[model samples]
Target: MNQNKLQSLMLCLLFYSNVSVYPVTPETIHIIISEDKTMLSEWEIPEELTLDTLESKIGTHDRTNETEDSIKYIWDHLGIVAKFSKNSKFLNKLTVFYATTLKNEEPKQNFKGKMNFFSSDPNQKVEATYKGWICRFKLGNRSLYGICKGENRNLEQIDILSK
Candidate 1:
């Protein structure tokens, strides 16, 4: 091919590749587990905001009326799942699994993260923040939280909530 024609074809191919590689945004849900491993809670946010906005909202109290009993019930159910083979040792190794779905109909992508529970008293409060689609979880104590971030099917970061 002539130089000009070859360059034109390369540019067109590059443009198509770039556009086809657009990242997919999915609804993100943050799961929080109690220190005692007796409770599990979750909150979901739409996938339109930026990560900064989600971070700013962290620790903002938005009560969900989730009682200890409900959390316990869910924990029991989760324990029976074969994938959670270490459920018996949950207290020492608190875990939070992040999940996402496209349009509420597609199969979910599960991303696991570690969490440290400080207290499990029913009076203790829980909070979360959403930056874009990234979500963070915080328990009653200021020191405990988990960060969940990813694009559609992958989890890039899952760090403990510090400082």
Candidate 2:
């Protein structure tokens, strides 16, 4: 694909709420990751989104693609890392990472947190922290805590993975 078209597809993958990842929810987009496919997280894309709009909203950053099939976008200050696979006229196979500190840790955090399951407690809240990411959700009185690392290094040219 051309440069303009590539950028457009990246924007669509990063900020399209109508797009579904797992076909479970129409409004919420969820992604699963990990060696065993045990981690999952929710993401929200902007309603009015475009390449220019994303840059303005998240500020300038770096983009790297060693080949036509894959690309990675990084916004260090904004704590965002996005990876995409290009197969169709429009790119898909999207993965996004937003950097965040876990609880009281200092900023610029990078670590994969552990997943915890707790029994239902009506008066208590669920809590979890992984690496630098934290996920807290409630199902009735049950609580789930999950975390996944979302940072990546840019690949050099001639890399097989990018190829």
Candidate 3:
């Protein structure tokens, strides 16, 4: 082959190799919150947990029932996590950590916090910001805030924009 053609071929190969590839193997992270008698849980790790898993494990209903909204929210967020990991690196890291923690810890009672959405693209960076006694545990500069109040209120909220 001509030298110019050979050089062009090598350049093409180099370009292809340099393209970023996301991690395919699913990594799971779990987070648990409990206060008094109330307990809240979230799983974000494992990029493989699909919409089906979320729907089945947490019920695939809209937030209509005051009694079941919390559970429905959890599954909805899980679906969001699956979608988010497809694009954002920071979100993947956060979900992985969150899921792992929840998977390991035993359920508890009386914990209050909010899960806030964060993003770290090629543009901006953020650190955990807390209000009052609330402690923010950030992952990849992004977060999904949740808060459990006393033994009666167990809230789990997920930020849809994390991805």
Question: What's the number of clashes in each of the models?
Answer: 6, 5, 32
Candidate 3 differs from the real structure by a C-alpha RMSD in angstroms, to one decimal, of 15.1
- Report the C-alpha lDDT of model 1 over 1-163, residue by residue, as the tens digit: 5999999999999986654432111222234445333222233332232323332323221121223332111111111111111223121222223443322221133443233344557677667666665655556544333345555423333433211
lDDT-sorted candidate list, best first: 2, 1, 3
Best by TM-score: 2
Runs in model 3 lying further than 4 Å from the true structure: 1-45, 63-136, 139-161
- In the order shown, what is each candidate's alpha-carbon RMSD? 17.4, 15.4, 15.1
TM-score of 3: 0.24
Q: What is the lDDT of residue 60 in candidate 1?
A: 21
Candidate 2, superposed: residue stretches over 4 Å from native? 1-44, 47-49, 87-163
lDDT of 2 by residue, 55-116 (tens): 44334444444456654554433233444455433222222323354322212332232222
In order, candidate lDDTs are: 0.34, 0.35, 0.32
Candidate 1 local Cα displacement, residue 28, angstroms: 23
lDDT value, residue 86 of candidate 3: 35
